[model samples]
Target: MKAGYLGPKATFTDIAVQNAFPDAERIGYTTIPDCFKAVINNEVDMAVVPFENALEGSVHLTTDYLFHETNPPIRAEIIVPIQQHLMVHPMQYNKWNEVERILSHPHALAQCHKFLHNQFRGVTLEQLTSTAAAAKYVSEHPESNIAAIANELAAEKYNLKIVKENIHDYDFNHTRFIVLAHSHTEILPSLTSTYEKTTIMVTLPSDRAGALHQVLSAFAWRRINLSKIESRPLKTGLGHYFFMIDINQSIEDQLVKNAIEEIESLGCHVKILGSYFSYHTQK
Candidate 1:
C-alpha cells in the first residue's frame, strides 16, 4: 500500500507516517493540503496529516480542509512525541553565538518561543512550509549564520549538525495525526489496534433552546465517556456552526449508536467521521 505525508522528509508528519505505516511505500507532498488532495484524488491509498498539536492546538489547514473540502473517513489516529532541535550546515560553525537567524515552520517556532527568547534573544526567525523543509534549506544554503529548528531525523536526513537538542519549551510536546483514506473500503481491517475512538460531526437544530445541552445530555444519560468536544463554523453564515464530538469507544457499541439516535431525534444532524483505533507512540 502507498501512503502520503507532508514532507521533503523528516518532518513530524513524516515521522508519524513512518511509525504508523512502516511497511507501506511513503509518498511525500509539499504541504498538508496536498496530502489531503492525494488521498481524495486516489493519488495514494491513504494520507497522514496533522490534526492537532498538544502545545499548539489545531492545524487550521488540515481542519479547514477536512471541514470544507473533503469527507474522506479518518482510518486511524497517531500521537507522536515532538522533539525539536537546532541544526546548522555541517560546514557552518557550530556555535550559538555565530548564528544570525533561525528558520523553522511557524508551529515549531511557536513551540520553542520561550527558549528562543531566552537563549537567542534577537535572532531573526523565519517560517517555512515544514520543519524538514527548513532543514533542507539550511543544508542547501551552506551559509554560516543560519540555523533551523527541526528534529533529529531531519538533521540526519539532511546531513546537518545538531547545535542544540530538545529546543521546544515544553518537554511533553506531542502532535496528533489522523490517518485518512478514500473511503471505508480502503481501510485495512486486519491492522486495527485497540484504544478505540469514534469522532462525529454534529450540527444543532436552529432556533431551538438548550439544543447543545440536549446533545450532551444524550451521552450523559447513556453514561458514555466523551474524550473531546469542539465547535466549528458551518460556513453558511454568522452564528451557524457544528460540533465535533469524540467518544471513548467505537461506534459499533450499542450505547454509542443509541446516543446518536437520540441526538438526531433532537433535530440535530450527526455524521460519523470515523470509528477507528488510536496509536500512541513513546516519547
Candidate 2:
C-alpha cells in the first residue's frame, strides 16, 4: 500500500502517517491539497492530512478542500501528540539566542505565540509553508542566524539542534489527522481505537426561519450525540454557509440513519463525509 502526506518530510502530518501506516510506502507532498490530489489521481492508495489541532481549532484549508475539492471518504483518523520545539542549525547551536528570525508554519507559530513573546521579544517571525519546510531551510542555510519551530522528528530529520523542547504553550497539544481514500483501507493494528465517528456536511435551506435549529433538532431529538458542529462559508455569498457536523455514532446505527432521513426531509442537503473509527497512537 502507498500513503501520501503533507510534507517534504517530517511534518506533523507525516508523523501521523508514519505512526498509523508504518509498513506502507510513504510519499510526501508540499501541501494539503497536493496530498488530496494525489489520492484523487490514484498516486497513492490513501492520503493522510491534518484535520484539527487541540489549540488551533480546525485546519481551515483541510476542511475547505474536503468540502469543495477532493470529496474523498475518510477511512480512519489518527490522533497524535504534538510537541513543538525551537531548533537551530548545528552551526548556530552556540548562538541560538542571537538568532534574528524564527520560522515555522503559521499554525505552529500561533501555537507558540506566548513562548515567542516571552522569550524572543521583537524577533522576526516568518510563516513558511510547513514546519518541516522551515527546518529544511534552516538546515540548508547553515550560516544564517535563523531558528525553526517544528517537531523533534523534523529536528532529527534535518540534523538540527533543539535549543528548546516543548516550546508549544500547552501540554495537551494533539492533532487529529484523517485518512482519505476512495475505498476502505485497513488501519494499523497497533493503534488503539478511541471511538467511532460519522461526519456529515449539511446545507440548511435558505430563507427558512429556524432551519439551522431544525437541523440540530433532528439529531437532538434522536438522542444522537454530536461531537462537533462548525460552520464554513459556502463561498457563494456572505450569508451562504454550510455546517459540518460530527456525530459520535456510526452511520450504520439505526438512530443515525433516522436522523439523517429526518434532516433531509426538511429540505436540507446532506453529505456523509465518512463513518470510520478514530484511533490514537499508543503511548
Candidate 3:
C-alpha cells in the first residue's frame, strides 16, 4: 500500500499509520489535504488522515475533505491512541531559563492548553501546521528559544529532547484516522472484513424535522449498526450542513451501499468515507 500520512515523520498521525501498516510503502504529505489528494489522484494506494482526536477534538480538515472531496472513497478506518510529549532541542534544556515561547500544531497546543497555562504561564505560543513541522522548525532554528510539543519519534528524528513525557490531559486519548484509496485491488479483500468498517457522509434534504431521522432510519430499518455520526456546518450555504457517519460493516455489503445510494437519490449528496480496519488497537 502506498500509505500517505501527515509528516516530517514522528507526528502522532505518522506513528499511527506506521503502526497500522508496518510494511506498507509510506508517503508523507505536509498536510492532510495533500494525503486526501494523493489517494484521489492515484498517487498512493491508501492515505491515512485523522478524522477525530480525543483530546484536541475532530480534525476538521480531514472530516471536511471526506464530506466535500466527492472523488476518492475512504476505504478503511483506524483509531490509534496518541501519546503527546513536550520535546525541545537537546541543547535547549539548560536554556529553559531563556525559553520564552512554545511551538506546535494548533491542536497540539489545544491539548496541552491547561498544562501550558499552568506551567509555562506567560510563554508566548506559536502555531505550526503540524507537530512534525513544529519539531522541524525548532530543529532548524536552534538559536530561537522555541520548543515544540510532539511525539517521541519526532523528537528523535529531529534531534530534540523530551522536557515532559505523556503531557496529554487524558492518557487514553486517541485519534481516529480514515484510509483512502482510489480503487480496491485484488489484495484488498484480504485486508477487509465485517470486522472492518464503512464510513459515509450525507446531507439532509431540508431543515424539516424528519430529514435526519429518515436518513438514519434507512440503516436502522435494515438492522445496520452504526458506530458514529457527527454533523458539521455545510459551509457552502446558510443554515445547511452535512453529517459524517461510520458503520461496522463492509462497503461490499449490499445493504450498506444501497442505503447510501438511497440517501443520495433523495436530493442529498452522499460520500463514502472508506471501509477499513476495526479499531487499531494499541498493544
Candidate 4:
C-alpha cells in the first residue's frame, strides 16, 4: 500500500514510518498536518503521523488534527525507537571543532539535549522543521561552522559527514506514530489479532463530572484495562471535545465489542480505527 510520512526525507518521523511499514511504498511529506490531510483527502492509502515523543512530550498539532479536525480515525499505532547521529559536510568541517552551529528538528535536538550542552558547549543551535531539512540546509550552506543532528539514513541520503555517533542521551527514546487511512484499509497484511493494544476515539454526548467516569467504567466493569486516555477540543464547537483511549484487549474480543456498544448506547460516538501493538504500527 502507498504510505506517507513526515519528511522532506530522513527525519525521525520518516525513519519511524520506514521501519514500521517496511515493504510499503514510502513517501514523505513536509509536515505532520499535511500527512494527516493526505489521508483525509485520500491522497495516499495511509499516512504515518507522529503523535508523541518520549522526550518532547506530545505532538500537539498532530493531536489537534486527529481530534479537532474532521478526518478519518487513527487505524493503528506504531512506536519506533529513536536514535540520532550527527552529520556534517566533511569537505567543509573535518572535525567537531570545525563546527560552531548545530541544526536539527526541534524534537531531535531536544532528545539529545545533554549531548548538545556538553559537547557543543556555547555553540549556537538552529531549529529546523525536520532533521532531513536540517541536513538539506547544511548540504546547501557549505559552512565549516555548521552541523546537523539526524539519522544515519539522512547522512547517507545527503552524503553528509558523521562527526559523532548515537548522541541521544537515552538509548530508550522512542516516538509513537499513528496510521491514518480511509476507514476500511488501515492495517497492513502482517497485522493480525496477535496485537496487544487497540486504540480508539470517542465523543461523549455532553461534558459532566461522571460523564468520563460512566464511559471508562464500561471498560473497567468489563475487566479490560486501559493504557492511555487523552482529550482534545472540537474544532466547530468551543467547549465540545473528543477522546482517544488505549485498552489492553483487542477489538476482536467480545468484551471490547460489548463495551463499545454500551458506550454508544450512552449517546456517544465510538470509532475503532484498527487494532495493533506498538512495534508494528510504524510507518
State each model's CA lDDT, in order.
0.86, 0.90, 0.77, 0.80
Candidate 4 shows a clash count of 4
Q: Give all TM-scores, in the order shown.
A: 0.92, 0.97, 0.88, 0.84
Error of 1 at 141 (Å): 0.9
lDDT of 1 at 36: 81
| Candidate 3 local lDDT, 1-283, one digit each (tens) | 6778887687777876777677888889988888877777788887777778877667888777767667576656677777778877776888764578888888888888888887888899999988889889989987777888888888889998888888777678787777677665422422323377777788788788888888888899999999788888899777788988878888889998888888877777776666666656462
Clashing residue pairs in candidate 2, if any? none
Q: Which one wins on TM-score?
A: 2
* Each model's total of backbone clashes: 0, 0, 7, 4
Which candidate order results from sorting by TM-score in descending order?
A: 2, 1, 3, 4
Better of 1 and 3 by TM-score: 1
Q: Cα miss at 271, model 1 (Å)?
A: 2.5
Candidate 2 backbone overlaps, count: 0
Candidate 3 error regions (>4 Å): 186-194, 254-258, 261-267, 279-283
Rank by lDDT (best first): 2, 1, 4, 3
Q: For candidate 2, lDDT tens digit of each residue in 1-283?
A: 8999998799998888888887889999988888898988889999999999998899999888878864679989999898899999999999999999999999899999999999999999999999999999999999999999999899999999999999999988899999999865555534778799999999897858899999888888889999999999998989888999999999999989999998898889898899999989742
- Candidate 4 lDDT by residue in tens digits, 188-279: 63543245777778988877768888999999978999988987777667877788888887788999989999999998887775565555
Better of 1 and 4 by TM-score: 1
